[model samples]
Target chain A: MIPAEGFFWSWILPALIFGVSLWATVALYRRFSR
Target chain B: MIRFGSIDIFWTSLFLLLMVGGAFWFYRLARRSESDFFLAGRGLPWWLPASSVFSTHTATDTPMWITGVIYKDGLRGLWYTFFSAWTAIGAFVAARIFRRSLAYTQAEWQSLRFSGLGAELLRGWMAGWQVFMNMFILGWVGIAMGKVGELVFGWPVWVGLIVPSLITAIYTLAAGYWGVVMGDFLQGIVAVFAILLVSLVGVVAAGGPGEITGKLVELGQEWRLDPFAFTGVSDGDFPMLWWLTMLVIAVVGGFGMGTSIDWYVEAQRIQSAKTVRDATYGLWAGGAITLIRNAFWAVSILAFFVMLPDIKDTAVSELGWFRLGFELLPMGLIGVFFGAILAIHLSTISSHLNLGALYFTRDLYQRYLNPEASEQKLVVVGRWTTAVLLIGSFFYGMMMEEITQWLIFALWLMSAGIWLPNILQVVWWRFNAWGYLAAWMANLGVSWLVVWILPGFNLLPELPDHIQFWLLMALGACFFLPATFLTKPEPMDRLVQYYVMTRPLGWWGPVHREAVRRGLIEETKKESGPVTRSMGIRRSWTPEAAQEWTREDWIAILLSPLVYTGLLFGLVQVLLMQMEGFALLGAAVIGTLIIYWVIDPKLKAVSEEFEAGQARFLDEVEARSRWEEA
Candidate 1:
């Protein structure tokens, strides 16, 4: 089994990066649309 | 022969078909207008060009190169490309500068900034040099794809070189910039998926970050983890002085190229954006994508190191990226990864072909051969130029072997001599065409004499990169300064026009005075008193008409690098699986949000104002054209 810590490091960080990126992208788009 | 299974082939074929279908869709949307063909009618939303910019920079060789660097110098080695953060910072400021200039291409920008014979000469020189550089860049990236083919499919060099080049050329020629950008959007998604897939597999294969750290510590290579650790150490893969030099090149060179209208496709992206805020956001988006991409590459390299500790002596070490995919990825997934590589290669190549055709057809043919040519005729010429570039670069890629050694040799050959002139042309008022021309000539001559010519005569040993860098700087200054003083500056009227329109932040004292005198700028009165025309009184030429940069702009511009640096460090900690570093990740998140809060409202306000102003200007232009026709 992959360690919980391993999943946190490998998956969580990238997921955060992607999640934040998507949020930021949407925020930027809406900012312009207004 | 362990050939690919039917599933692998099917997956790859499906992706290719989708990309080709995307090409046809964009082709249908493209009109016969030159602007549509070259720039997608300059009506693209921020994300299109943003993702296109992100995708274009991810050349196929990028993964292989990053993996090789890790094999040689560890994680600290990423400073080579990481310094590009400066370019992103510069982009924040340059977005407005590029849009306000309103020139179709970087070469055409020469006439807008200057006038007379000097402007004409600069335009011609830039057009010629850009065409050559575009072809050269296309060839370099082509060589990388060729390596990818050889590594993955065991195909001969030429097959890898020709096939992708031909495919990309066809779609680019058929749909022009519209197709190229749309294709990039689709390809960027696949590329991201592939990067994450491989990185996740590598981490799991290495028994997670904990086991990987143990292996590294056991090997006495714990220094591999720290970014700033071995900077000045003399006994490492890269010494302190060498690291400093690379830092300077990345930051300074990146910022210089970032701000200047020197690169073709980047400036095209800026012009292609509908509003200045859209252009600025594109850069921000591109930077975010790049940072994420780099983190995944770093993780993969670290995992590769742990898994293959004993395979240190052979060329296989340098090919760790491909080796990891083949060794760790399942059969069906391997096919997806190959499709991703093709996506990477095609996206970059398509942009180059489109932009190269742009420079050749618009700048050379239409400008010189027939200024009265119709837009339809120019589009035809553009297609022919694309074909020539695609064929030419493929043949050039075939002649290359052992690109690693060649890349090193090319670095030594060219050095960073062109950097100073490039930066100064934007910031300084005195830098002119003759000055720029002299700098390039001197850099080339001096570099050849010092690094190659003199070494041939056995008079001087081959110098290090730092030495060559300094020599180029010294010689570049020696030539450009004398040329500036010797040749006449651009006309004052032209300078004032540029200053009023662009409103660049720099030393433009004389131009500011002219603008004030001509009523183009209103001098702010601190007190209601009669002003005396004293030559010595430095009037703070605050042009009321010029859009003043707000505090938000300043924060976003100055704090971007800090925010990214925080995020990079925070990501590194998380990748190492240290729970305590989650606090750092929290700090990074807070910092990014702070930037977003500061810049978002300002960007919206500014974009609205710019669009309104542009609408009025276009209306006036239409009215005048109609009057003349009547």
Candidate 2:
């Protein structure tokens, strides 16, 4: 099994990138819709 | 072959049902009109098309291609993928200009940008070429799916090519781009999740990051870890000169539309956006995510390399990422992974189907065959065209025995010779339709001679790909530049109208003055006074002021490449736990923040001003399509 740091870099970091992108899209939609 | 369990079947079925059912739900909206079918009614918010951009670009072949390069050249191979970075500057520059033009297709934009017989011929040529290109893309991508199916279930290649494409065609035929963009949002999420999960599992399977790095040092391949590992300035497989050429192509090429073949697909997304700002942000954000996703794939491929360092065949090694997901993932999760693969495949298929149909319906059928075709008849023609393309792709896919060779040739054919002309069309007022048309005709013959004909005859040495690019570009310029000067410039009225509408940047001094003289727009003061008081950057912009090129736009264009480079190298290094990676990532973030700060206000002003006149411009576009105006 990978250590916690390795796991974070390999998985969590990319997950964060995706999550943030999706969130920003939502926010942009709200801003523009208004 | 791997066996599928009940849970695996359930997950796979669930994804398919959701994608097809959800897309079919948009039938009513897509059937509304030609615009609604082709462009989602030109009312999509930034995120909707943004997601579509990400998902549609992430084809089944993408991982295989990325894995092949990363496995061969290590981190340095990522430069091959960086060509997508055109969007970094393009979002601010070309995307804005294109959104203002409000043309439904780039082929249609040709006529709008130029006038008379030359413009008409160029538009016709571009429309037909786009139809062929889109069908070609569908074939290659479909064959990639066929290969995957063969590996997984022992199916014949044709079964793999035809089945999923026919399923994807269902939604495309039913709902057009409405189905495409909506379906893409869901697929984008699933695809991203799968890439992260499988990559994480692969890294763990390589005995973790610590072992992988230590093993690389033991094997004397530590250079693979360096993103800038150039073999030499002019020699070897990965040369410094090649890297520089790629950087120039990726960054500077952004100033022009259609510099990359990908630009044709992006044109649709840019028009689908509701406003100029939405289009800009959508394109930039989508491209950002694509690069970040590449970084993740790079790290995972590195892990694959460490685990199996002795794999000699590139074909076998190219399956590295898929092998990680299939061979390493747990049973139930394997199904989810396969579902994501299907998502990637279907998204690409659906997009090209609709896009090809758009070119056929709007540019060919509606424009030439029946100018007065009703909206309902056009949508029906679109559906019929979608079906025809699906059938055509099967023939192309079956005939294509070698994917990599054809893919490389096609990319070179599209990019190298036409690169300069693509930019000149956007920037130079003198580059009329005849000149652009001549460039396309010349590029075809020149590229053939430089890439294959002369080299095969042993008259020319087999030069490196970068050298070929430069040679092809130089020779192409010799033909097209003369053709441009020999022909008269586009008529003053046509030039003035294009100038006032799109407000294109660079070398448009005469047109700008004419627009001002005619009172089509106001001339701005030099504004060394109160207007220029803020932070040495002009923050406030009137619509007229924003129409002119400014220092802020230049700053964003120059810094954009640095951001892409930083994110690409930084993420890979960070995954390897390197300290410098963190620093580079920080620099990239700062660069992005600065770009947004400097440019957003001007973009907003320009978008607001342009949108106010959009309805009138749109009606004019409709008139041109019907040949009601010359």
Candidate 3:
């Protein structure tokens, strides 16, 4: 079995996710309005 | 390292109070009316359902299960993660096209969509299989929760196993969806917060995310980023192809399974929006946040594996959760997070426990046993079903030595089992009842014959793994559509009428008199059929669906929830991001206020547009489409 590798950077993804969600919310809402 | 600690009186009191209080608060809404019990009286705005979608999907052992995979593989689990993105996105797609589809459960939708021998066969298999699959899935969730309980509080294995299930059944039986949904909303919030807290604390505890990475690099374990980085130990254990194969199954073919209503919390969120516009906004935004949350757990586990390799691999039993909690959180926070786990587990247990009973009452008992049963009687049967099934669910988990495997299998089976007949029939014009029947039979056969036999073969070679069975069933189901379509097409009048009301752009043929007549035709006219309404869905699905739903009140509902979710997400991002530009801040503030203004007006304008469909929705939801409909 390949040894499991350990690394940490899950935090940034959530932040990035927060960003993408906002962008999506704004965009989808705008499309809905128009 | 993470700290395992005791829950003081404050937390102990808080946990009990929240568990008891939250359950009651939710059930109180159910008392307002049976509709309230089953459908939250359709009073809640989009945000609650949207948020609960994430919460509902975030099960007790989900983090550990997914994390366990990452611990074993590297970023390869992203195959599961990315394809799974289609869950919300596909739901959003469905929401836009079929916003009012929530009026019935998934099986009822199948029954309504098909007719003759095929329809009967399809519905029967669906109703039965729905129960079997739901019970199995609910069992894992029950086990995971109990396991967590045993690990955390040092409770007896049996007590830990039984308590949450019993407590959840009580609330779900009393409040029905109202109890589950209301409780889920809060639990979902706790889950997101708990995830955030754990990640932040884990990072700080590990001396920052950067430090965690540095430590990992020093340990010679920094090669996890190359999604395909693996030293092949087994032939088909996993190559790059494994990731690619999973991506196709999970992402591409996943849309087929998107229509199942087992987790109708998300569907209700979309359905209960002030307007189709507002509802989709909540779902879209909520879905977006949820996807991010999934990624958070995904990456955090990467840090975890690097941070504490000695933490050791553990099963999804009580001992495993106990060790994980202590190693992952600080003192008071551990108590707080453990409480969150209870909330998560209870939300699932109550939802499934009640839903499982719902299937028994609606699909089997009412349809098969008592056709004339009143809603009041069904309600009683449903409660009893919940009670009995929940007790059974507790033991279901205990039977599994490696509960997580069963849990994962349950999920895959649930997804693949219904994936074939659900989406393809709804969205694809070529799909038919015969195909759905075939798909279900193949799924049932494979699930029983192949999955049942995986354990014996795993110790040796030559036997297909359980997951491979899932892939085969999903593929076979999807492929069934094209094969059946070539041989036969149901007449336009019978099933097509249902399609006409639900889909405007999707029905085939040119956009003239022929198309109008074709669109207007139902199943009754199939003997003298016009041309097929082929092509694909039109661009204006959301607005068009709303137009059929509400004549003049379209713009308001469409705009308001959008504004509501917009303001909320926009405000959240601005506060969290704090970027340098005045443009950014102005855009955030302006966008939010605009959305807020739209919510009230749209809600007021379209208040009564939904009245007629409400009864039908109740019929399907409370009767034909109950929880097992998923």
Best by lDDT: 2
Chain B TM-score, model 3, reads 0.75
On TM-score, the leading prediction is 2
TM-score each candidate. Answer: 0.86, 0.94, 0.72
Q: Write the per-residue lDDT of candidate 2 for residues B1-630, one digit (tens) a residue.
A: 676667677667766776676676677788989998999888888888888889989999999999999999998899999999999989988998899998888899898889999988988888898888888899999999999999988999888799999889888899899889877886787788789989888888888778878989999999998878998999999999999999878888899999988999999999999999899989998899899999999999999998888889988999989988888876666777887899899999999999999999999998899999999999999999999999998988988776658666877888988999999999999998888988989999988887788989999998898988898889888888999999999999999988899999889999999998999988886534457536888878777788788898998888888898898888887888888899999999899999999988988998899889999989888988999983
Candidate with more favorable, higher TM-score: 2 or 3: 2
State each model's CA lDDT, in order. Answer: 0.70, 0.86, 0.54
Summarize candidate 1's per-residue lDDT along B1-630 as a digit string, tens digits.
134667667667766766656664566445467777888877888888888877998998787777877766677767766754654465666666666666667777776666666766777877786776667677888887777687677888777778988888777988898888878877887788778877878888888889888888999988888777675554445677777776566545533432222245678887788887788777667766777678778877888887776665536666776666666666666666777788889999998888888888777787667776777887888889989988878655766564545554544434377777766767677777788778777876887788778989998887767767777788779988999899998878777767766666556678777888999866644434443323433122222422555455666666677666666666766887877557776776787787776666556655676676676544432232123211
**TM-score order of candidates, best first?**
2, 1, 3
- Tens-place lDDT per residue, model 3, B1-630, is 234434333453465455545555455446554345455655556766676666767787777766776666655554444443444334334554445544323554556566556765766666676666667767777766666666555666667667777777767878787667667765665567667766555445556556655776787876554346645633455654555554445434423434344334344445555455555556655655665665556555655666556655356321332344456554555655666777777776776665566556656787678777766776777777777777666667678566667666656665656565566676556577778667766665666545566545674344334346456555676657665766566555544445543442233343223435664532222234232222321222222233333322233334333333333334322322324323444554575454344333333332344444546544654443333341
* Candidate 3, chain A: TM-score against the reference: 0.58
lDDT score for residue B381 of model 2: 97
* Candidate 3 error regions (>4 Å): A1-34, B1-7, B32-34, B226-238, B257-275, B310-330, B402-421, B446-488, B504-515, B518-630
What's the TM for model 3? 0.72
Candidate closer to the true structure by lDDT (higher is better), 2 or 3:
2
